[model samples]
Target: MADKKNRYNIRDHAATYWENSPKWRRVSMSIAFIAFFYALPFLNNPLVNTPGSDFQSVLFYPVGMYVLMAIGLNIVVGKSGLLDLGYVAFFAIGAYTMAILGTHTALNFWEILPIGIALSMVAGVLLGTPTLRLRGDYLAIVTLGFGEIVRIVAVNIEAIGGPRGIAGIPTPPDLFKAKFTILDPKPYYWVLLTFTLLVIWMVRRMAARRPGRAWDAIRQDDDVAQLMGVNTLKYKVWAFVLGAAVAGAGGVLYASQILSIVPDQFNLNVSILILACVVFGGIGNLWGVILGAALLAFTPERIRFLSQPRILVFGIALVVMMNLRPDGILPKKKREHFDPNWKSVEESGEGEIK
Candidate 1:
């Protein structure tokens, strides 16, 4: 009876200690971080305009797009280590699909979003199926060419409005049916923020799972991954599909926000900018990519006083990042290993036997 009572006391103490301790502290910190994120648009300095409350909307849009693009690229370049130069192709396809579908049919922005995503998935699979068989620089070149093809088609296709591009895309209406209209972008800001968070969460989940692990192994060495029974082709195609889907979602949101679309909007330069964000942020780190995206998206606008020199500064920033911190702003931590353990395992002739 005494032992049972003592055991109950121990369990109670443990529970009480946890309740009063750092576990709660960590949870509180997480809640604070989330609050901070939601409040960021509301907290603005002089460089960003917030006079009429539109600044919050303006700021959130850029950040949201960058976050979305970074997440998409994270799947391809970060998880799978695919050096794709044509990722913007998926973005263009999504935006254009949303534009055409919404504009041509009576279907509204909300209705067209799912269709846009489907189109992006199909495009991803179509492009990835053929190119996943290639490797290294060859894959990059092929993807680059594919991107150019997409842009060229957008430019030349008359039914899609050709080089002039499509304009007058409708914005998403208030779904809540508020009696009063929301002229301010605050509502849209929240919507985009929610969308961005959802995408980030999804990307993080994928990165923590078997799919992400398989892609990482394939990234390290396709031959070794295949020997380990990882379906290299299956995972590669999935990476492409998932990455394209995210990009497509971004495109739909962006087109709706801007209410305009141009072939130039989905050009080679866009791809480079997104790739720059991914590399600058830390290839394997989602949070790092978010930081990188924010910097890339907002830096020039903040330094508009520099005028044309902003491009020079941007170029310098990239050059310095490569030379000074080649691993990126948030590099992966080096994994520690026991030397004797490695030697013993190696000496066991396990690898040789295989």
Candidate 2:
């Protein structure tokens, strides 16, 4: 077994890797550059609207949501080594909760935000409880089933508008109750941007704590983690809850931006799309997941002219990626020096390795 001090030393190095990743700097700069220029359309710049493009506003919606979802899933699949196929249910629940409670009913947007969180947390617990006892393929199957169930329920439940879903969701309060509505989407972009950054920060913090270590232990080997006194059930649930919270945040943001909710929007396709982002990007790397999400979200639109063949191309690309770089384009954690018995000065002085 590795010494405890040695493990801490390794964690310190891994922490430093996150603090010093050039990948983050590149991604941050790219986002800033895009944001700075994306507003040209709002400026009514005719040049920004190439021949027949109506995508000045709607384009950013997918980008924002994908980034948020990828970051959220990164917490579970990347950091904790849990394969969650039904994560999209949380997003659906959040969006629908906000839609129903924040609109059709008398509750306001601000009032429903807490409800969204609470409902999502409860959903997370409910989903996690039944699956944590299972591992790997079984857990994946359970989550997939859960996602299907949610989508089916949303479509069949008449109260939530069934397959037609709900529309005309209320927008957030305007600036000091001004005349302008807050559903224009540019504002939502900023909101999601801020939210994404917060999720990343929280993920990094949680992934560096004792709970994070427990997750790692379980991921590496649940049996070993159990032998080491780590409560696999507790940590597994933590992963699900945290991941669900991020998804819920995305959901609320989606409702605020689109001002609508639909069952079709949160189907198995959504789950597969998010999982593809995480898998293609590199399981544990948040930035990679973000990159994957952006690529998958943006590329399809870029080549829509090809129609059905374009999807084939995307599938081919994924196949190539699987064949060529199965580990993913950006791996969350890289191999580092693994010294099982590296001693600190204090430890060496006390001869504690015995």
> In order, what lDDT does every prediction score?
0.76, 0.75
Stretches off by above 4 angstroms in model 2 are: 1-59, 175-183, 336-354
**Candidate 2 lDDT, 1-354, residue by residue in tens:** 223323333334655865777997768966886676445336554433323334445445566688788888877787777788898999998999888877667887667877887788899999898887886767788889999999999999998899999988887776544332543556666666778877888887887898889887776667778999999899989888988988887898688767777898898888888888888877777767888887786666666667779788988888888787665776544442244442343255321111
Question: How well does candidate 2 match the true structure in TM-score terms?
Answer: 0.80
lDDT of 2 at 180: 26
Q: Estimate TM-scores for all models.
A: 0.84, 0.80
TM-score of 1: 0.84
29-114, model 1: which lDDT tens digit per residue? 66797777777767767866534335665565666677778878888888788888898999888889878877887887778888
Error of 1 at 15 (Å): 25
